[model samples]
Structure formats: structure tokens, C-alpha cells
Target: MKKLTSIIVLSMAVAATETVNAQTVQKRYEENPFTLVYDGAITRNEKGKVNIHPITYQLNGITIAANIYTPANYEVSKKYPAVVVAHPNGGVKEQTAGLYAQKLAEAGYITIAADAAYQGASSGEPRHTDKPANRVEDIHGMADFIAQYKGVDANRLGVLGICGGGGYTLKAAQSDKRFKAVATLSMFNSGEVRRNGFQNSQLDTVQERLKQASDARSQEAAGGKIRYAGVASITDEEIARTPTDLYREGFVYYYRTYAHPNSSFLYPMSSLLDLMTWDATTNIDLINQPLLMMAGSKADTKYMTDEAFNKAKNAKNKELFLIEGATHIQTYWKPEYVSQAVNKLVSFYQNNL
Candidate 1:
């Protein structure tokens, strides 16, 4: 019995050492010299002649971290149009969302990008909870907070959601008329993909997957270990063998060139319970504001944008613009595509807001 106890103690010490090494070796902005790490990032802030204000506020009892970008020569007393930019799943406010906010602010608008609760520097228990309802509420919270910001013209507010956030923006805009214009870039329908599988590839295993999710939930309720799903890590050979450009390129974007420590495409396994029951296209026609949907012409996930755009039947003015010769992930960072999308967004918000 004494020998058995000693063996267990030694095993636990080894396990703890491994966990510490994993934490220490994770990626950071310092690894990439070109990484724009903070809000109102120093180098670009000067180049763009804009300012980024890092702020925090309470949302539903949780502290939310965000960045608000003000246009050059901003004046608190003067009325200015504002936009709320929502980040993609597994993405933080400081990444592509911040890039767009900075660009839009340079175009003479006040913009904000925020981390979702339970993710990316935000405070919440059971970290990485990716529920649809919580994401929608985050958008509303942004609107509520920004509408009251000094110099903002609440009457002329707009919204731009990227990837999964795009789907939630559609749902939020349906009832949140405070958003005068709504737009999406590379829109990905989380619920549709979760329920039926990406590109409808998991139709046969729906019940099997649901059972797994149910079992995970039961485990958590009984005080067992929390189970997570999605890509925690990937190898070069696996990415090379990936069948779709969307995921293959996405792996490069998230895990290599633009990697960040907090950015991960994971969610609790039990999240599938709510995710499988939700669809981003349902009631999409309820969006009464002007809508603009943009997707890369070659994006494998373009079908999601196409479906949602077609269903936004009641939008006051709707336009579908395609960026030629770019894939879904490329739109997030490639220079030409980013410029093209930003130019279109500027014009849309100018005309509508």
C-alpha cells in the first residue's frame, strides 16, 4: 500500500510538470514582430492617425474587455456615426475585428470591437462557453454601451459581424432596430454548420453526435472533468491533407502566421446541445435594416453567406458583393481583400447611415 501511494504521487508530479510546460510554450504576440498586439496598437495608431481606447464594462455581471476606436481629430461634442464590430469564433477583439475597427475609424467613424464573455480576456466561469444566446447578448451589450458613449450618434449606429459573429448579427438585427445598417464579411452560420455539419457532411451522424454531447453534459453535472471539442492543435501534414481550402488556410491563419495565445477554436462539448438546435437563417427576413453581405468568390463557406443573403427578404436595401479570387480565410488578412471589403463597407455605411 505504501508503494502504491508513492507511485501515484510521482505520477501526479510528472503530470503537473507537463501541464506547466504546455502553458509556458503557448504562443504570444512577442513571437511575431509584425503582430499588432493591443488596442490602439502603437505603430498603426500613429500611421492611421486614430486612437484606440481599451475599456472594460460589466455585461450581465461579467466583465467584458473591449476596444473603442475614435476617428482622427475626434471631438466629443460633435455627433459621429458609430459601428460595432463583432469578432469571429475563436477570435479575439484584437485580431481581425480590431483591424476592421481601426480601418473604419480611419474612414471617419467611431467603432468598437469586444471579446465575448467566457472568451478572450473576458470574465466568466466555465471558460470558452460558445452559446448562441450569449453571443447575441454580447452584440446588444455593445450597442447599449456604445450608444451612450460621448460624441456617438446613437441614431446612426451600424454593425459588422465576421464569420460566426455574422450569423449572430443577423439574429440581433432582426429585433435590434437601433442598428441602421448591417453587414457581414465571410459570414459563417455556426448553428447551420453545427446542426447539420459543415457543408452538410455530418447528416448521418447527428444522433450519434447528440448522444456524445448528452453524455458530456451528464459528466459535467456529476462533477466529472469538462470535455472540449474542436481543434486544440494541428500538424503540418494534417493541414496539407485537409480537403477544403477554408480549413487548410484557416489552420495557417489561427495557428501559425497570426497565432495568439488566447485565440483557440474550442468550446465545451456540451455546447452542442444548444448549438444543434439553433439556425442562423431562421427568421432572417425579420431584418428590416439595410443589409450588405460580402464573401470571397472562391470561399468554400460562401454557401452560408449565399443562403443567409437570400433569406434576408425584408431588408430595406440589400446587396451581395464578392471579392474576386480570394478564399474565406484570406479575407481576414490579405491586403487587397481587406482594402476592398473596407472600401465597400465605408460606402455602404455612408449611403445608409
Candidate 2:
């Protein structure tokens, strides 16, 4: 009876702790008007310090919402290197992409992080459409806009994509010679995962999934109700029960700690029709520019990066940097890991850009 009582008390304590943590996170989210959830986020733009400019531009007839970060004491008369940052699938510019853009600005570079077409604050129909071609085009659109910004040195442009954005960046850099340097963090191949499942766990269900995606597309064509896939919301217990560190931590990060109203995991089910047939590594050797790919040393998604990195045979000055002692999601916000990544990125861009 004593042992049973102790166990029950422990369970209650754990539950109470989780409740407190969730409430704290909720309060933080509500307090930030910009919906910026990262640590040390800029509250207001000031001169002689890093400043953020929220701007929108028309991209292929869709309005693209982006945040451009200008360095401390920025002068439009003096040209500065610029980077176009691509966010992960289901991510908005206000999340990790914005954090990196802000950090890069502090390092004296002009950086722009934009919402993909049909996602975030950007304009599009059947929202959260996750297609490879559309994602790749979004990166191109960012480069097109930032290259024309007043203080940007268009010739010294670079691109950095995170997670699924990394996969699309690989695709974008293949044909867009405007990006002088290309880098990726925690690279995730959306095509491979959508078809094969994470870590290829659903190999046997490929055909079945493809058929379902095809049907979804057919329904859309017929003007039927649009369907969405992926997690809309999750419980703490569900998050704790998730087996993979990438997913379990991802749930807590996206739905709890770093939750934002505009950020979501849902994507149009019809999007799988385009995503399933695509691959980020196809013709990767076409990327002849300088390349840097970083991933957590212990990330389950590291294999995707490894496969893509190795296939970029023609890339100049190629490197694969592993952030020590980090899982895939940890690199997004953990201070130690984020610091390491930012430093490496600054060095890489300085040398190549």
C-alpha cells in the first residue's frame, strides 16, 4: 500500500508540473504581440540596433509576407550581403526562420524570411498546400525580392533553408545561380518522407498512400470538400507517448512551448499528389555553388541530409557540419545548439559569400 501511494503521488506531481509548464508557455505566447516565440526576440525596432521590417510583395500573383532584418547601424548607401531564409514545412516566417534572420542581421548581413505561398500570412487558396514545386518557387521569389532591396549586394546573395525548406532549397539552388552560397539546417526531404514515411517505416504502404493522395486530388478537382492531413492539435500524453525524439519533441515545441496562431502542421491532402512523386536529391549535382549542410549529430533525420549531401558531387567547397549532442528539433531553439549553428553559419557565409 505504501509503494502504491508513492506511485500515485509521483504521477500527480508530474501532471501538476506539466500543467504549470503549459500555462507558462501559454502566457508567453499571449504576451508577444508579434507572435515571436523565440528567446530574446526583438520587441520593437530601433535605430543603431537590429531592426525588423515586416513587408509583403507579390509573388506569382500571391502576396508573400516576409520579415527583413537589417543589421545594427545599417546604412542603405553601403551594400551588404543578403541571405534568403526558407522555413520548414508547416512553419511560418515568425518561427525559426525569423530567429535565424534576426541572428544573421546581428552578424551584419541583410536577411529575409518569408512565408511560403498558400501558407502563413501569405495569400493562397486551399491553405497549407505543401507542394515541392510551389515551395521551390517560394525560395526563388524571396531571392527576387531581397536582391532588389535598397542595401543588398545582389551579387553576394546566399540561401539557407531549414528542415523541409532545406530540401526545397537544394532544389532551388540547382537552377538559381543567383545564390552564391547554399546552406541547410536539419535538412528534411519532404518527398521521401511523404512517400516512404519517416525512417522508411511505411515502405509497404507506399502504393496505398499514393492511391489515397490521387483520390484526394480527384475530389478537389470535382469541387468536393477539401481534406487536410497532419496534426491539428495534440495532448501532452500523446506527445509523451510518441516514440521518436524528432516527433515527440516536435509536438511539444510546435503545440506547446512555441505555439503560434498562424503556425500549423496541416497540409492539403491533395498536395501529396505532387509531393509523392518528387525527390530533393534529383539532379542535386547541378548545385555547383558553395554548399554547407548542418544537422544534429543524433538526429534521426540526419540520414536524409547525408544522402542529399553525398549526392551533390559537383557542389563547390561542400561541407557537412553536425551540431554535437542535439536532436533535430533541439537545434531550432536550444541556446547552446542554436549558438553553435549561428556561429558556423556566419563563418561559412563570410568565407563564401
Candidate 3:
């Protein structure tokens, strides 16, 4: 009887902990419609000033959830420059993407940030699909939707992508001529990392991982069960023990301080089939629009930005700017770094857009 009671008590404690976590997340989300967790996020929309509009649209038969921010005193009759902001991998439209969109709106540009089809509040089945082609198409879909929006000048449309979205933006810009100028912040080459592994740390396991992904795909096709890769949750101790500042801070941003119920690191294991064979730097000469790529000077992922920038041979005008004394995730929410990035972006867009 003693052993049985101990097991019951332990299970009850675990369940209670989970319930509290869930409630906490719910309270945070309810605090703002934007659900923004970053410091200095606008909590309310003011009329005749920067305003946010929650919207939904269809993309390849899937419903996409998005937030569009219009500049102060926006008028449908007057044409204005516009930008499309793409969210990061395993990210929803509400986090850093929304933060940038709000900032750009304040700078007088109409900006829209949307949740990818299989993530966030967007519609999808067997959730958390993180395929590259779908992500690239999501950017295109945003351009299509936002171009027709009131007061937007389709001819002056620009694109700004963050993190993994940065990689997809590069690919989309290669074919989508609508984007007159393109910029990326803290660019993470999803394909390069997925294929070769982070900082080339998993080269030897490439074949083995590919086989695992293939098997997972087969199992999914056979309706056996779905498999997922990546972190769903982490303890504070695990985060403290993380070796790299990028991941260490990333865990805090995504899992705790800025935590959102919808945001997760999980992706279908089968996604590796496409991710392992792709490269963001491929067909490097196709980008003819002006490009501005920014990263933290101390970011571990700065190498990815450097590699992509060097290969953008055909960009009309290209520059790489570094935020001083900042790390990868730091660029996401740190006020000082975020201000630096936004100012550079404002100037870049003003000159080119």
C-alpha cells in the first residue's frame, strides 16, 4: 500500500505541474492579441497611428493566420511602400516577426507577418511540418496577399526575413520579382545546417540521419505513426548547461521568457528528406535586387550570413552590417541590438524601397 500511494502522489505532482505551466502560458497569451513577449511591444493599437490588423487568408487550400500593421494615419486612397516579414523556423507569427513588423510600421511602412501553413494558428494536419518549399511558398503567398491590400504600392514591395525565414526569402527572391529590395537578419541557412549539421558538426552522421528520415517517411506513409525531431521542452538546468550562447538564449526566448503555447522546436522527422538535400546558397547569381544582410558581430551563426553575402554576386547593391557585442538570439529581443538593426533597416528600406 505504501508503494502504490507513493506512485499516485508522484503522478499527481507531475500532472499538477503541467497544469500550472499550461495556465501560465494561457495567461500570457491573453494579455495581448499580438501575444508579443518581447520588451517594449505595443500592447494596444491606436487609431490614426501604427495599427495592427489580425487577418486570415487561403494559401494552397490552407488557412493562414497573419497580423498586418499599417503606418500612422494610413489611408487606402494613398499609395505607400510595404514589406513582408517572414517568421523563423519553429516560430509563430507573434514573436520576433511581429516585433519587427510593428517597428517597421512605426517607420511608415505597411508590414505583414504571417504564421506558416503548418505552424502557429495556421491550418495544417499532423502539425509542425517544417519543409523548405512550403516555407518559400509562404513568403510568396504573403506578397500576393499584401500587394492587393489597401494603400500598398505593389511596385515598391520589399522583403525582410528573420532566421530560417531568411534562407527561404533568398530562394523566393530568386524567382519573385515583386520584391524590389531584400534584407535578412541573423540569417540561418536551414539547408546547410540540416544537411551538414550545425557548424558542420554532424557530417559523419549525414547518411545515418537520412536513412532515419527515410524510414520515418515510410512509416508515416504506411500510417504506422508520426515521428518528430527537435526539442519540445527543456528544464532550466539543461539550458544553463547548453554550450552555445545561440541555443542557450534561444531556449530561454522560446521556452520561457517569451514562451508561447503554439511555438515549438518540433518538426516532422520526414522533413529531413527535403531539408538534407537543399542549400540556401544555390543559384547564387539569381538575386538581382539590392540586398542587406545583418547579424550580431558575436553571433555564432554570423558565418552563415557571411557565406550567403559573399555569394550574392548579382545583388544590385549589397552590404553586411554587424550589431556590436550581440549574440544570435540577443538580436531577437535585446532592446539595444534590436534598435540598431531596425535603424539600419529603416535606412536601407528608405534608400531602396
Candidate 4:
């Protein structure tokens, strides 16, 4: 593992080659307003390099799909470093998770970005219902699968999460020391944020939250679908007034631009019930590995990331990186911004893992 100090900042140049991807992603969203579809697999064959192969594993006794990307130079004779990257809420591995995994894999790290249980390609009876015990288990489960891979070092395993996955990764790291290092990009403590917004300032009372979730459950039981109140697509009127609103930023990526229409996750409104029971900050004292938290300066959840970093204890190595001119959703699939975030991740893992 690497030390917490002596950092390096990598520069990303906008090359003409990147334009094709930009245009393709742009066109996909232009056609589909609700879904940000990817034209093809994010992990592809690079000829002289390796290809991203679709791999399946069982999670929760269901057949789940995962994309495993091995480095072009990977050989079965030796073990290599690996990272398990989880996607954001309402996202599939084909979107941001798969992209990060492929990029890191190309850089010589065996990367597996899997779809979480009950979402995307993973098997779950009730669609989109995420459980803390099971979801966190998903993170460690992926690590176990990677550890047994033919070329994995097993001892040098690491994990990463984006947004909601960010919070869950911490929970996974606390008990599952199998991971040598841990990092988060645009981290979101979903359990904390779902029950309360921005530092528990919005919903400070457990009774208030219980009322809402319970009411939603009752409505669902009455044969009505539980609806979501959070932001999905923000209008211009709302955006101009509250430009930094989480929903507004989410609209820019998940709906308008940089949105992958072909992604496979369904945003289940009822999952809030499960989320109401989840809280990653409750047991912050348990994490004992290296922790790297990355967030964008323009992101609203700066507090979410900060709050998590502050609560962490006994972590052998820790760091907090803030990227300029980016918001919460902007880091999801935005190439320019994600490049910076992923590079920090690569360097962090390189120096430590």
C-alpha cells in the first residue's frame, strides 16, 4: 500500500479522439429524453489491447451480470492489482461504473464494476429495492470474485464507489478488510441524505421521516405505486433560480447531457423505505483501511462527503480531494470531470495499493 502523502495531479487533454465519444453520447440523449442510452458497451475491444468481457456471477441467488476488464498485458502466470467500482444510484455498470472500470483496467488494474443487487442486471425479486446488509455485501462479494480471478493478487484488492455507492463502500470497508484500500468519487451517504438533507438539517426528527416512509409504504400496500418527490428533471425556471440544486444538476446529466439512455437501472420510488433504515455514519468508528474521498467544489453534497470523512476513525491512511468547477451529477459520466476524478483514484491506488 502507498502512503497518504506525496500526491500527483494528472492533466487530461481534450483530444480529437475523445470527440467521437462525446458526439455519440450527445446524440443518444438527443433522441431519448428520459433514458441516457449508450450506443455500445463502454468497455470495448482495443485490438492491440484487451477487450471487456461480460461476466456473470450470482448475487442473492440471482444470476447477475458484471463486466470484467483485464489489462492488455495481463498474464495468467502472475497476480495483478484490482479495483471493484460500484455505480451511482439509478445507474448501471454500462454507464459510469463500467467506464471507470474499463479505464482503470486499461491502466493495468483488473477492474470489475458490477451492477448492484435488485438494480440493473442483478437479480432481485422486487425491482429496485436496495438493502444495506445485502448491498454492502455486494461490494465485498465482488471483491471475493475478483480475488479468485486467475491473475488477481488477492492480497492487493481495493474498492471504489460513486455517489450512493460511495457511502456503502465505507460500510463495506469497516468489516471487510479484504480490501487493501478504499476510495469514493462524489460520495453520497444515501442513508443520511435520504432521511435528511444536507447535514441532517432538513429532517432532524426521526418521527418526521418515519411518517413519510410509512405513509409511502401504506400507499404502496393500497395498490398504488409509491412516487418519488426528489428531483428527476429540473426545468429552466427552477435551474435559473436554484442552479446548484441537486435535482437540477441531476437533470443536466441523467436527463439532458452526458446521460446514458441505454443504462439498465430502474429508479424505484419504494426503495426510500429501505433507505430510511440505512445509515453509513452510525458505525464510523470501524473503518481501519486507507480512505480517499473525492468531491467536486460545485457539488451540493460537499457536506455529505465532508461529514463522512470527519466521522471516519482508525483509518490507516486518509485524504480529501476537491475538484474545481464540477457538481454532484457532473462527475457521474462527464468525461472532463470524471477524468480528473478517476486520475486521482488511479494515483491514489497506485501509490498505496
Candidate 5:
């Protein structure tokens, strides 16, 4: 009985530690004036220094909440290269996307990161609809707004998409010529994963899942209760038991270390009707712009980036960069890994844009 008591005590202590750590992270976000969650986020916009501006605009009649970052010594009268950053699936602008945007701005470029429609701070009904078309449109919408922003040189525009955003970015860049240079980090093919399952683990359930998704759409059309897919919340125990490194680390990053109220993993079940039928690599040859794709060498999701990059036959000066000994989530916030990525990004943008 003494041994059992010791084990229980240890478990409780570990849980308590996790809770305190999560609270510390949450406190950081709540303290920021802009609700910026990333490390070193701007607390105030100052002249002659990198600044962040929270702005909103209409995209397909939906209000898109975005943060635009300007480099030090920015001037409205001078032309500057710009980059539109698309967030990962289930991520908001205040997370890794915002971190990257701020870093790019520090590197002497203007950058904007926006929440996807029906997600984060953006306005859309039947929230968290993860449609491929809508996500691709969000990237295009960013380009539309940033291209016209003061001091922006539209001709030198570039794009950086992370995770699921990376997949959508490929699709958007296929037709959106406004983006002169294209890049992706830890590209996740939502369609392929939703249809085939992570690592094809659910290939046997493909037809069954498709049927369920169809039924969900039908119910929605008939004004029935909306069904949602994915985890709305997860406990520490569940997170520890999650099998894949991609998912396990992702949960820790999104839900614990960088938790944001506006960020969630849920999506309308009906969204699978579109998501399962779409792919990021379709007509990938359409991307004729300079392309730079980066992924962690140790990430399980690296396969998706590899697959997409292989199909990008027509991308001008295409390159795939791998950060040594990094995982999918590490690229988001690990100081060393992030530094490596930001350095590479600055060099790529300078050379291409």
C-alpha cells in the first residue's frame, strides 16, 4: 500500500507541475496588450523600431483579424518588400505565425499574419469550417490586402505558410501570381491525412469516414445540429498517450505551452466533404515562382513536404531546406530551431524578393 501511495503522489505532483507551467504561459498572453502569445512579442509600437499593427479587413464578406508587422524605420513613402504569412491549421495569428511575421519584419520586410475565416478572431458562421477552398482563399486574401498596404512593393511580394497553411499556400500560389516567392514550413497535407489517415493508419476506414462526412453535410443542409470533428480539449494524460511525435508535440505546443483562447482544433464535420476530396499537390507545376520549402529533418510530417516539393517541377529555383534534429513543433517556438529558420528565411527572401 505504501508503494501505491507513492505512485499516486508522484502522478499528482507531475500534473501539478504541468498546470503551473501552462498557467505561466497563459499569463504571458493575457499580459500582452495585443494578446500576442509568442515570445518577444511587441508590447508597444514605437517609431524607428519594428512594430505590430492589429488590423481587420473583409475577405469574402467575413472580417479577417490580422496583425501586420513593419520593419524598423518604416516609412509610408518608401517601397518595401512584403510577405503574407498563413497560419497552421487550428492556429491563430498570435502563435507561431505571428512569431515568424515579427522575425521577418525585424529582417527588414513587411509581413502580415491573419486568422483563417471561421477560425480564430475571424468572423464566419458554423465556426471552424476547415474547407480547403476557404483556406486557399485566405492566403489570396492576405495578398490582396498586403499588396496595397502603405509602402509595400507589390512586385516583390512573397509568401510563407506553415503546417496546414503550407499545403493551402501551395494551392494558392498555383494561380495567385501576385506572390513572387513561395515558401512552406512543416507542410501538412490535410486532404491526404484526413482521407488516408496519419501515416495511412486509417486507410481501411476511408470509405466509412467519407460516408460519415456526407451525412454530416446533409444534416447541416437540413438545419440540424452541427457535428464537430477533432479534439476540442485534451487532458494531460491523453496528450502523453498520443502516439505520433507530430500530434503529441503539437498538443503540447498548441494547448499547453502556447495556449490561446482563440485557437482550437475543432472543425465542422461537414468540412471533410471538401477536405477529403482536395489535395495540395494538384497541378503543382502551376507554381512557376521561386520556391523554398523547409521542414524539420525529424518531423514525421516531413513526408508531406517531400511529396509536394517533388511535384513542384516548374517552381523557379526550387529548394528544400531541412533544419537538423528538429521536429514539427520545435520549429514553432524552440529558440534555437526558430533562429535557424528565421536566418534561412531572411536569406531566401533577400535573394529572391
Candidate 6:
């Protein structure tokens, strides 16, 4: 009888332990990981006497949600200079784009940081679709939105795009004279990166990738679940395998520390397949606006920035500023780097606008 009781007690303890472990697993796994925004930043819910509002704008028959951060002491009748902020490839407006918008707005400018179509709080069909033309149109759409706002001076408008957004911004300014001044920090020419290669040399890998994405479309149309392959969550082992450490740094910012409740490390996985065909640098000859393209000296994308700067012709005012010690993602949210970017931008706009 004593042996029987002991056995039963041991079994109960083992079951209880298993139950606790299962509960922990369920709690983490059940909470969807891709639904976060701002990572942990308070940009979306952040308050300012400048009247931050959640607004929606129509683009290509779809509505995109945007956070408009206005000037704190703005006057309704007075027209203020405005700057349109664009987000990174997979990021929403709440990430670095929102941060820059908030900072610029605090600097007494009306800043509209919008989520690209088919992603984040924005509404669109076949979500996570990436067409260079559509993305560029999204930027132009935001410009149109700001141009019609209560206190925005359309003539004094400027543009600031970070990373992939930077590339799209450049393309927008190429033809849209509406942008009096333009700037791109860590600009990524997606076409070059997608076709030629990362640093503009490798080719076979990109070709293979193109074939894979092209093949997947057929499988997708057959009532099949699309399997997206790209960087979502980056583990430490993934970081070590990279040729440069900057990519690892980028992963830390986008996937881990700044992971928003609505920002997904993997939500835009389908966008990668479309990215293979999108190019934001084809029409570089049309940027007549005062252009300021700044990049970190140590960034992996510095080479691409150089290529773009060389291509942008006929711009009367253009300058390329390289910060001494910064990486591609560093300028996104870091105070020291952000301030540097904003200062140059403010100076350029003030003189040009």
C-alpha cells in the first residue's frame, strides 16, 4: 500500500510539471508574433500638443492608415512646410519612419508618415504585394494627402525615405517637382540589389532566386499556401554566417529590440517574391529638386548610394553627406544618428523651400 501511494504521488508531480511547461508554450506560441508595430516604441500612441491623429488616405482604390504629426503651435490658416516620411521595406509607419516624422513635426513641420499599401495599418488587396510602381505611387499619394491638408504649403514640400523607402522617394522626386527638397538615408536601389546583386557584382544567386519566386506563383494559384522565404526572425547563428556585421545589426533593430506589437518579422514574406521584379532607380534623371542623399560611411549600402548619386543629374542643389560612424539601420531610430540626418534635412529644406 505504501509503494502504491508513492508511485501515484510521483505520477501526479510529473503531470503537473508537464502541464506547467505546456501552459508556457501555449502562452508564447498562441500570441501571434507578426502583429506588432513600433516594436516597443510609443510612436503610434505618443501624444503631442501638435494634434497627432490617425487618418486614412485613398490610393489606387485602397485606404492607407497614417499617423499625421502636426506642429504643436500650428495655426489653421497658416501654411507650414511639410515632409513626407516613408517606411522601410517590411516596416510600417510606426517604426523608424514614424520616429523621423515625429522628430520633424516637433521641429515645426507637418509630417505625414504613412504605412505602404497592403501592409501594416494600411488596406490593400493581395496583402504584402510589392510593385515598384505601386510603392512609388504610394509616396506620391502621401504627398498629395499632405498637399491638401489644412496648414501644409505644397510648394515647400520635402521628402525623406529610409532604406527601401529611401529608394522609392528618390524615384518619386525624379519626376515629381512637387518635392522642393529630397533626402534619402541608407537608400536601397531595390532593382540593382535584386538584379545585379547586393554590392552590384554577384549574379547567379539572384537568378536562382528569381526562378524560385517565379515558380512559386504557379503553386500559389492552385489553391496552395504560399511559402515565403526571407529574413523574418534572425537567430544568433544567422548573424554569424553573414559576410558583414551590419546586416546582423539591422536584424537586431528590425526583428528584436524594436519589434512592435504590430510589426511582424515575417508578415511581408510574400513581398519578397515581388521585390525580385521591382526597381526604384530607373528614372534618376528627373530629380530636379534640391537633393541631399546621406549614408553611413560604414554601411553595406554605401556603394549603392554612390551609384545613385552619380546617376541623379540636372539637380542644381545636391549633396552627399556621410556620417563617420553609423550603420544602415543606425540612423533609423538612434538619437545621435537621427539628429544628424534631421539637421541636414532641415538645413536643405530651409534653404530650398
Q: Using lDDT, give the best candidate's number.
A: 5
Tens-digit lDDT string for candidate 5 (1-353): 99999989978977897889778877988899999898999999888999999999999899999999999999999999999999999999999999999999999999999999999999998898999999999999999999999999999999999999999999999999999899999999999999999988999998899999999989999999999999987777788899899999999888888989899999989999898889999999999999999999999999999999999999999999999999999999999999999999889999998
For every model in order, what is the number of clashing pairs? Answer: 0, 0, 0, 10, 0, 14
What are the lDDT scores of the predictions, listed in order?
A: 0.88, 0.92, 0.91, 0.74, 0.94, 0.76
Worst 10 residues of 5 by lDDT: 17-26
Best candidate per TM-score, number?
Answer: 5
TM-scores of the models, in the order given: 0.89, 0.94, 0.93, 0.81, 0.96, 0.83
Residue by residue across 1-353, what tens digits does model 6's lDDT show?
99999978877876675566445534432352322233232323324355566789788898988888787767779889999998887778767887788778878899998888877778875666666777898999999999999989898998998888899999888888898889898998876776677776667677676676667676777867775655655554465576764567766666554555345434333454666666666778877778899999878888888888988886667899997788888878677888898888888878988
Q: Which stretches of candidate 2 lie above 4 Å from their native place?
A: 1-26
**Which 10-residue window in model 1 sums to the lowest lDDT?**
31-40
lDDT of 6 at 244: 64
Better candidate number, 2 or 3, judged by lDDT: 2
Query: lDDT tens string, model 4, 1-353?
Result: 13323222111222332455467667765654322253334323566585576788886586777878888867889789999998887677767777678778867899888877877767775666666776798898898789899899888898999888888898998888888889998888888777776556667675676677678778878988755545544344445466455666665455444555434334455566677778887787788888999999988888888888988867777999998888887777667887898789889888888
Error of 6 at 171 (Å): 1.0
How does model 2 fare in lDDT?
A: 0.92
Count: clashes, candidate 3: 0
Model 1 residue runs over 4 Å out of place are: 1-28, 31-48
The RMSD (Cα, Å) of candidate 3 is 3.6
Candidates ranked by lDDT = 5, 2, 3, 1, 6, 4
Candidate 6 whole-model C-alpha lDDT, 0 to 1: 0.76
For 123-233, candidate 3 gives per-residue lDDT tens digits of 997799999999999999999999999999999999999999999999999999999999999999999999898889999999999999999999999998899999988
| Predictions: Cα RMSD each | 7.1, 2.5, 3.6, 11.1, 1.5, 7.3
Show pairs that collide, candidate 5: none
User: Over all chains combined, what TM-score does candidate 4 have?
Assistant: 0.81
